[model samples]
Target: MKQAESVSDFYKRLPSHAPTAVPLDNAGIGHINVFSRETCSVVSPYSRRDFYKVSLIIGTGRIYYADKWIEIDRPALLFSNPFVPYSWEAESAEQSGWYCLFTEEFVQHSERMHNLRDSPLFRIGSNPIFFPDQVQLGELSAIFQKMQAEMASSYPHKYDVLRSYLHLIIHEAMRSNPAEHFAAYSNASSRVSALFLELLERQFPIDSPQVNLKLKTPTDYAGALSVHVNHLNRSVKEITGKTTSAHIAARIVSEAKALLQHTDWNISDIAYSLGFEYASYFTLFFKKHSGISPTQLRGVV
Candidate 1:
């Protein structure tokens, strides 16, 4: 039930005197920070983060991604985006990895950034975990090392150089396995389905109490997407094998579970934030989907 960890929270969790030299900008162009696992504190178990993370891991571990648990046995390259909830548990005590955290705005300066959504790194359903051979690992490690060095440097345009390194790392991972890259959709159904999923995911994490979900039903999403409700439902069903309403209900339940478990907010506040007209109605909807009341789920958690 934990909320997503924000960028400021990330820095606060780090040890004092840990490298903290990131550019502060007003344009929402985010800063980048690189760290070796050995030098940083362990992230809390099952906690979610609100930024993008790319890591060159050198030891075995398991990453809980969304509903899937992926085991990593070899040197691996892992990418985590903001939408998916993930946590890492290292299997080896002697774990070592170089990870760089960046925001969506950090990479917007490059043309390749436009294709980021289609890349396995940011794609919702694609596998973000990959095993790399020694050569690939070494190459990736070198990129991280360069990024770390650049971060500590006093050069005026160091960020520009760092952005280039980031692009290099992204391109290297994409090239590592051509077969894993997501292909462009050639059909309208696939395109619509992908867009629908994207739109749905963008409303997630429910990070703040002041923020409320605006799209709650199939008709709402269809209207936003400029499509008939039936057409939207058909496309989502064709691609995902689930009805649009089912998907919406499932997502709402997931968020409800998170809010119940992670926050101190009362049932009424939670229900209102999720677009429920009344707390009783929210309880009924939650119980219908989860087989338990929200309060019960919170107690179990």
Candidate 2:
């Protein structure tokens, strides 16, 4: 996967005259920025972002996220996370919106905030687009309006208030978004399962000690594939008759055995190449699955 765009790059892409005082991300807000009446869509190249964004867009456009596309003819809210790549194309020239872009650390101080990646709005493979009803739209926009006001306020505890507002918006979105976003599970399961297997296979060979397995766990693969971890597990299990983690472990153990038998690299190097931080951890994992330690396997083979 390609590197995600950073919040600094995001600022540089904006118009030279974009408001410099809209709580720019590098300020004391801890890498969070807010904008209103930002008529231009500054997103480009259709790649992931290092920061998460929640946009209140009031225009007609096609939103491309992950492998899916959504058309919007009405006011909508969108959640874009660092885990997924996305971009937008406006069908109309006139655009009005509020957007808040913040890094994960900005709101990760609390237990609930730590689960941001697993939330309904930002979770991979979940519907991030929501078309609120007219009344709901007004309410949502009002919240953004307040956020803007709070960002520009002189209050010492404004960010604390901002956090509360952010929570409210997220909760409201999850509660109010329609349930029509789900596709047929059987169809979805097969498709996601195939993609998951392919992605799982692509990280193979571990040809060098310097190389690291990028997708080491089901959660890591879920983030890479832009699907919720539970959803990915369910789909893979239903389609393959085995848990996703089981498949991952089986493949890793297979490769470990082969590496042990074929290569003279030290166990620590092999462990590092296979995404383990320590040889002991990898040894434990290998012995648990193979009934022998890596050294024993190498000696026997």
Best by TM-score: 1
Tens-place lDDT per residue, model 1, 1-301, is 3567777777767646244456434256676888887754344455567778898888777887665578889888888887777778877777787998887777776676755655776787678887877887888889999998988888978878888898888888888767647477868888888888778877876766666899999999999999999899999898889998898888888888877875788898889888898999999999999999998987887
TM-score (C-alpha, index-matched) for candidate 2: 0.61
Tell me how far candidate 1 lies from the true structure as C-alpha RMSD in angstroms.
3.2
**Regions of model 2 farther than 4 Å from truth:** 15-29, 177-235, 239-301
lDDT of 2 at 15: 63
Counting only residues 3 or more apart in sequence or on different chains, how many pairs clash (N, Cα, C under 3 Å) in candidate 1?
A: 1
lDDT of each: 0.79, 0.78
Question: In candidate 1, which residue pairs clash?
Answer: 1-262
lDDT of 2 by residue, 174-256 (tens): 87744633333469899899778767755654556788889999999999999999999999999999999998998789778
Poorest 10 consecutive residues by lDDT, candidate 2: 177-186
